[model samples]
Target: MDNKPLSFKGLRLLVVDDDPDTRKLISILFELDGAEVLTATSASEALEIILCFQPDVLICDICLPDEDGYSLLRKVKRLDIEQGRITRAIALSAYVMDEDRQYAYLAGYQKYLHKPINLDELAKAVNDLAQLQQYA
Candidate 1:
């Protein structure tokens, strides 16, 4: 086995999705890229982890139990500003409407991913978000 660590080693990723399968799959995907991944099944759960983990990147589904992804995104941005922390975010959903994508970006997501997502795209998003953090 190669002893070298993966590119994302030590990076923290928080994935918020109400679907267990989706959450697990994304967590595994990020882990494979060497990130420490945290999964939440609801927006409230995600908020809790966001406060505690202070993840390097957030991958969030647009639909959630208590609130939608846009609401969650707003909460995250408010939390970061209140606490003086800056974090990058990616919005993931199956919506795929022009307005949906626009809403995500307007709510502060740096990038958007349509669901039934490609593993390669997810990996690249994580890497890109991490790189963005370095420059932010």
Candidate 2:
């Protein structure tokens, strides 16, 4: 096993999903790894939290209650550019279609995570985004 220790401390991550169960699971995973996790069940709430937290990374579900993740991501991109907040974002969704992945990239997600996310992958994405933020 490549046992490189993972430290999620000091990383602020936002988990946006309408599914409570998935949100809870992902939140727990991130918390277990020592990250500051924020949850938003709706796009409006997410926008509010995003404004306040300005998280280092975003892990958003592609399908939301009010709006799709792409729309929200576009808003985030605008905010990031306008406010100079370069937070790296990732798309978390069950849709694993190649077109979906392409759309996510086009929508500005730095990474795309499948629904049943591997914990290791999730952790790595957070760490990588944190590093990218540090460098940015």
Candidate 3:
């Protein structure tokens, strides 16, 4: 577990997962770290939130209730490109297979994380994305 306290004071984050517990856990973690977090229980809701929130980073589960994370990310990517917004995404899944990871990258996720997520690592990843955005 990484103990480093990440600084994400003003970063906006969206967490999409069908499991309410997962969403709540991630939301709490990010909020504790100073990130403004929004959560969606399904892919469709996620898309709607994306349009309105325009979050800086999105952490999504691979297996969603309505649509898969790959499909969600693809749509999000299209919307981002169309609107000229840069929103980096991360794929979170219980599947740790190489094929799954590869597919996530092909679908436009910048990072892939397995479930039973380490909150510290997630914070670091979000912080890193925020830093990268600053450089970009």
Candidate 2, residues 46-96, lDDT tens digits: the string is 999999899889999999989999999999889899898797998998999
Compose the digit string of candidate 1's lDDT tens values, residues 17-101: 8888988888887787678999998899999999889998999999888999899989999999998888799899999999989
Please report, as a residue range, the 10-residue window in candidate 3 with the lowest summed lDDT: 1-10
93 Cα displacement, candidate 1 (Å): 0.8
- RMSD (Cα, Å) of model 2: 1.5
The parts of candidate 2 lying over 4 Å away from their true place are none
Candidate 2 TM-score, C-alpha based: 0.93
Better of 1 and 2 by lDDT: 2
Flag regions of model 1 displaced more than 4 Å. Answer: 1-6
* TM-score per model over all chains: 0.92, 0.93, 0.93
Residue 13, candidate 2: how far off, in angstroms?
0.7
User: lDDT at 68 for candidate 2?
Assistant: 92
Error of 3 at 34 (Å): 2.0
